[model samples]
Target chain A: MCLLWACLLRVSRSTSCFSPVSCSSWAAAARRCNRWVLGVLAAAVAAGTAPGSSVRAAPGPRRITTDGRRKQDLAWSPDGRLLACSLYHTAGQIGVALFDPAGRLVRLLSTDPVEMAPAWSPDGKRLAFVHVTHSGTDGELDIHEMDLEGKTRRPVIEERKAFDMYPSWSPDGRQLLFTTTRDRTQEIYVSRADGTAPRRLTSDPSLKQHPCWSPDGKEIAFNSNRDGNFDIYTLDIEGQNLLRLTRERASDTWPAWSPDGRHIAFVSRRDGNPEVYVLNRDGAGARNLSRAPGFDDCPAWMPDGRTLTWVSDRDGGWDVYVLQP
Target chain B: MLCIGEQRQEWCGGVRRRALVQAGFLGALGLTAPQHAGLCSAVAGRAVILLWLWGGPSHLDLFDPKPDAPSEYRGPYPTLETNVSGMQVTELLPALARRAHQWALVRSLFHQQNDHGIAGTIQMTGRSPQNGRVHPHAGAIVNRLRGNPRLLSGFFVLGDRLQQGHRLIQGEGGGQLGVVYDPLRVTYDPVAGVQLGEVQPPRGVDSARAGRRRSLLDHLAERSPTPTPARDAEALGQMYEKAFSLMTSSEGRRVFELEREPPKVRDAYGRHRFGQSCLLARRLVESGVPFVQVNWSTHVEAEEDAGDGGWDNHYRNFEMLADRQAWPFDQACAALLDDLAQRGLLGTTLVVAVGEFGRTPKINPNAGRDHWPGCYSALLAGGGVRGGQVIGASDARGEAPAAQPHTPEDLCATVLHSAGISRTDVLALGLPVEGEPIHELF
Candidate 1:
């Protein structure tokens, strides 16, 4: 499979300058080659006949999710023992679920139909997520913090008539930042730990989403489409010191800061399909952490800052994967 | 064979058979009845101009906006106040908002059959396709009741021909009523010019000249010892005569010459094919055609995704509606209403703008609205319709009808009723029309 890919890469480089052929035809050839390689690798891995497997104990990123469901908005628990994510089953059930580091189903936190954007509190005792209930076309979205040990879930930010989503707990756990369309457009907002007294931030006329606080607790990173397509941008807690991180034409979203505050991991379509990419804090030296086929989205940095957990559909369906970059 | 039934003569099963035979005989002699030419002169009576929005449009985003509904349901845009009190439309329709007094809205329109093909047939025919039997198109039934009137056809369909898959969409053509009542299908292009390929005679064959040629051919055929030439001649000769009349008549030619309209008036209708088609519909109605259907676009979903194809909006509904679908519709519809009113044509022309169904209110994960036949909206203007009033209401989320729920057949009945075609006449013709004329609209 590697040899075929290498040959195709060489062939692509040689044929790229041929003006008579359109780029779409070249893309088709590359796609055919990739599909063949993926099919062969999948067969070998399934039959246990391959000496060198892609998911073996090699020195590279490892896939943790294999449930064949759509997993999104992945976040590591404060202690990093488990990962919480929103899973959409093929049968049309959407809920939040927890998984151990080894990718085992720990427990479904909530199967409340329309839940997404699960965030763990800094103390690791509670989970904060958005639970939405729709009535035909009209729906209510509210943030709920669930007690891990009991059924003591309570509303955090119950904006009854708004799409308040993508909640994140501050490093100190006293405040939460979330994206809401309460003002007619998607913008970021800050709320108290109890989800009260919400205050608006980042009031751009365009859509802003997937906000993550920097490890230092002073800056918040989020993706916005204020500049045509979505790109990552960071702003301070006071809504000042705005900085643009990624400016590629392709969509770059779901920004997550490393534990050491040195790098920001994001999902970008720059490489053709969505892939996990890491860039320096100062917006330089960007490199892809997951170069596999299929869509890779919502990368969350582990506490150790060496591993990044994300959801990928490369194995035919979405699963959580941990990459050591 | 043409005897009366046990109950009533008009309700007899052989009425359709007799009608067909009568049509055939008259068609053979080239004495087809001219229809509704005096329809415009009759006070309070009017012709119908149908702006068929092929796919279902989202009611929440356009007519029955739920500003107070939940964020996901209300969508991103704010509602704007129209010229009429207690009425509001989406900010996307500013032009129509200003002209709210000239039109009335039926907000509680609903029907079954969510599939595009089935719903389109039901809405267009005003009767569901039952047991695999296609009903006559509403226009066909109207043309049947009010025969061809001047030298022109009564029903005209302008723009790209409507289709589902490779076949003409159900109800787009004549069904059990026979092809004689089928709409005069016409295609128009700004650069390539108007094409009436099906209705235009061979070059240099004016109406008088074509009639002379037909007589000569008939004389030759009678001399020849050919069997069953009379029936074949009747059908072929009928087509040629209709084509000749349409291609050569001064009135027919004048209605198609869109360059007669001022440049400013043409620009007001937008430069797109759908807008220009609406402009052409006005001309046909003015020329005394009883039913003129202006299709929004030709290719529905075959060329683009759902939303771009006349409001299917299966993917990125907000972006597609905000960018591609809403503005052109608002401009063309508003401009049409203005033009019709200024020319005093509104009093005699009933304009109905609607789609097969409405989009789902609960947006899917793709940010697109799927087909929802449960509830939708239709706009009615002119033909003595009470303007600035909403006929019925949908629920807070614009999901289903809350008051005076009406089906697609009922909407069709309303359109036919506005055109002064009685429900009794429709029933006598063996059509499956349902609902009343929406008394509130009248």
Candidate 2:
């Protein structure tokens, strides 16, 4: 059986030269290998040990949990006791929820109707989202703020036809920066926390979205398609200095600064699939921390700064998992 | 005949003997089976041109305006009188109104699904996706039924095929029918004026070289003994033949060449992606293609200070519709209808314009509309359909169908029927669902 397994592996590797005779030989070898593997697995079960543990251990950062829904745009409370996540379902509507540290659903912030890009305030007392509406003749989407109770909702801006989305509140809760289609091009706009006197910040023809502010509130990181494909970019709040952070030929989005302000975690498809990666503030020392087979996205740093929480589908569904740095 | 040997019995009862006797009996009439039955003469020569609104366009604002409705439900645009008395259309669509005598306006098209993915499947396939799984589009069914004879291609889509969340917008192509029935997609950067990167032939490979390559490939295919390889080689030969024909065919080249159009005519259509696509559709129909679908895509990125251009207008309803969206559509569609009429192609070509669903009647605080799947409008012109007619009606608020409510299946059936293809005769390949073409319009 061992010899047959080895022959089957060898034949499988040389599939480019397969012929009728080799095909029959390969079938025989594969059957033997299957039986041998089954036998080893059975023996391991009897011995109370997992088979192929050594082989599986080579891939670092093992999967902890997952759920089927597409999880993205995640955030953690200031104390790191709860994780806020946006759950995307097949119907195109998004549900915002909070989970305990043990991966248990603690609260359901919103559900059913479609919601776009939900963000928690710095104090985690209020949630900001874009409310979508459409008349028989026209349609509109505007920014709305809701308290933790899902009550006391009010519109930040009441301009019809303009699309305001991806609201990110400042750490001091005095100002907010969001992406809006006020000028026909998606540009970043800054407004007071109460949504007063919105000022357009970015003015390029490129598409800008997913704005996240730094810990010190001096620098803002966002994703833009200005350079052809979506990539991570950072700019000062005053719009005086602009910096390109990523240059890979893949979509890099949803940049979140670590609590310590030294590293940034962002989602990228550079490795053939969406995974969470961390790079230095200056875009160096990039490493894939959530390299699961399925999509691993929407990484947020815990307040402790030692562990990161992200949404992954390693368990056949999207769920929150923590990675210790 | 009595106790004949097996070989003799076969020979005596063979079709050749039967044919000889029949020919001898009908010698003076000179009629064969095919001629007698008129089967050869019944070949379909009709074609259909579809104007696909990728994101759902508002029915109330366009075809089924309800001016008497409440202020919020009534859209921003005013209704205009058409050539047909008592018929009204959006004022912006003056061109379509003038040619109202040439087409039928359906106001009560309805479906169950409001989601773009599901609604699109219903509209394109005439049957909703089974178990919510993606299915082949309608153009694919047509392509498979009638193979592209001129090698000019069968199904063609002129925009993005998919929407947000990777949902398959139906009518784009064959989803599971494999690539053979997939529409010859022509993707472009609408804002940047970039054509499809794939359609361009290899650099320096002229028409003569391409023809030579095709002949070589065909010869190799004929000599190959293996069935699989031979089949693959033949398919490749067909592809090359098509590519060569498409590249060298004067009609094909002329159809895609927008620059050759007179400046006044081009300007009349407005300088927008949808307008350009509509113009291209006219060109393709003139080139003898069976099915041409022009998708009005909503993938335009948010523009700074500019209202949302796509149909998924969820925020600023009046400002966007009046200033940006409706004007370009008005001018281009008007020009297309006018052009088709002046060229005498309107009688032979069927033009259909519709979207997945309509928007809600109640206005939100943001002055925008949400998706409404209960009722909508669809416009049909040419191809022998009765003109100057409104088939159905909506309520005062245009909220629901007040008269005859037509399903996407019904509209698809009408399209097929107009193209001289009987819905009952043509069966969808690989789908378990059954469809019968709508006969009411005919």
Candidate 3:
């Protein structure tokens, strides 16, 4: 299997630059080769058939998990020692599952059955995530923060009949930036770290989601359908200077600002399906980073802006993978 | 001789003849009439693919965005224009938006039952049984008239046993039409592939072994198989025969080998259980199965797992749609329509995608939509139906029908009518169909 993968890799590299091949055909060969090789190595390691040495020597991209379950909302810890992601700990169950930088399970953080979009606090002592529960007459969704022992008390953002999600903490950890449907339509809001004294930021009636504070803490970036379909948008802390960064007819969402603030990594449907893409902070020099022909989403930058962790279903099921671009 | 008897199980040639004779006797007594008495033409090639989105999907957020409604009512999500004129759907359905010309939507479908059980029954069987008698599933009624191939039972339900409130959903079984008319429920395990249930022989038991066993079973059946007090003996006998055939007949079983589909085709369907099941539903209908109902999930689970949970979105409605549900549905349903069209089966196959009811027009405290049976939407395509059309209209707030309100009976009647079964034919089968076909579709 290794030899076959190696030969195919060589062939794919050789054919990629050939002028006569159409762009799609070129992509097809390379993706097939990548998927086959990565799927094989990951499967072998998962099955315990390959020793650590083979996996260490043969891989191109590191697969976080070969279980082939859907995983997303990747967040690298502030100290850069751990990764937090929403992964299925059991069949049909999704929650915050932590992993070491090398993809070893650190611990299963929450068992809420549906907690996701985890954002680690700067001190790495807590994980703020959206927990959804249908225990109420209707259902209730609120962002909650879990301490090191996986204990959650008061919600960070909970209103009587409102939804608050995608809790991105201000860089200083004194404030929480999130999107809520309280008081009015879906819009961004900033509240005290303990879910108090909330102030509405955006007045757009259009739906907005996945709000994250830029590392500099001076601006906020989110995806909204404000200009029609969903596109990447950024604004200052005061919700002024709203700038649309993407104009593709297809939806662009789930923006993760590069740690260095030079670029934004987001999921784009411009290619007709979800693929991880990177564009400059000003939305220039855009390119598809995960060009494989299937759903690739939730791109998050590592402490080093060069690496990203995302989820892809290209190998037939949702699995986490890491690649540096 | 048309046989109508107390026995409801659909049997093979000999037993079917017996039932026809009994039915003829009943017809003579004016108790029931033969379905052939109807003036409707039964199209042998016509089939129906019912994509049962088990739990109620939000009408406000999906087909009817109600963009101008109040914040509490409209929630989030904007609408986008479709290929069809004067029709729009939520941006979550971009794929479906592009292919809107290939399908039509009925915006005002409603029933009084907000509970999943009764509503599901009403939708699947056309009307709930007020007389305390379970009505046959529409598929059973369709099969009673159109008659599916013996190789693959005409009606196939792809998913596990669906239940609510700890009991199986009301109309999933064959109901009073007898266990035989009950759909052949097939479970597709994402990891284990197609779990064919009784159709597949046990491990270490290959086809040849199963074939010998089948011969024995056939001989036993010919000699009058032992009584099954739990179910009709003839029905069990018929099921045994079909399972043997599936195991023995390469062509019959190969239809299930979804891997036979191109990787690209499978990916095009979005690579999940629901998506693949849609692909399988298409394959079944294309192979001449008369009725196929693809249950979105085995059950309506409000809490989340990955994406396989039902559409009951009482909470986390937007998250469920944006994260797990909507796009995959759009991609798969669109792909199904596209594939059927490409295969030229679209004209013969009637594709209906709907849920038991719609979600609340108001967004709930949990950012989810609760069950609302007052108004909903259903999508239809193919089977001689005109596409790129909106059959009805919803109120501005999406709380009720503003124009051309239709009932679950109308939805069922539409499926049957598209499969060439008429309202009179349903009556002839001793089944009551309350709503007439929405003729505007054609």
- Candidate 2 off by > 4 Å: A1-325, B1-44, B131-135, B165-171, B175-178, B187-197, B202-236, B244-252, B298-308, B428-440
Candidate 2 residue lDDT tens string, B72-101: 576545567789999988654656777788
Backbone-clash count (model 3): 12
- TM accuracy, model 3: 0.76
Sliding window of 10 residues with minimal summed lDDT for model 3 chain A: A11-20
Candidate 2 achieves a global lDDT of: 0.63
> How close to the true structure is residue A178 of candidate 2, measured as C-alpha lDDT?
90
DockQ result, candidate 2: 0.02
Residues B1-442, model 1: lDDT tens digits: 2222111213232123222222222121121223224534432336888998876778888888886776556665556678999988876677898899999999998888978788989888888878888988778777766544343356778855675544457787668766556676666543334555344434334346545654654554455443333433454455545544443334335456566676457667764456678888887776566788988765444122211146666544664465456766887898899988987889878899998889888765444578899899999999889889998899989888999898888888888887778888987977666767788888
Ten residues in sequence with the least summed lDDT for candidate 3 chain B: B26-35
Q: Write the per-residue lDDT of candidate 2 for residues A60-82, one digit (tens) a residue.
A: 44333333344666777777676
Return the candidate ranking by TM-score, descending.
Answer: 3, 1, 2
The regions of model 1 sitting more than 4 angstroms off are: A1-325, B1-45, B165-167, B200-239, B242-251, B306-308
Best by DockQ: 3
lDDT values of the candidates? 0.69, 0.63, 0.73
Candidate 1: which docking quality band?
incorrect
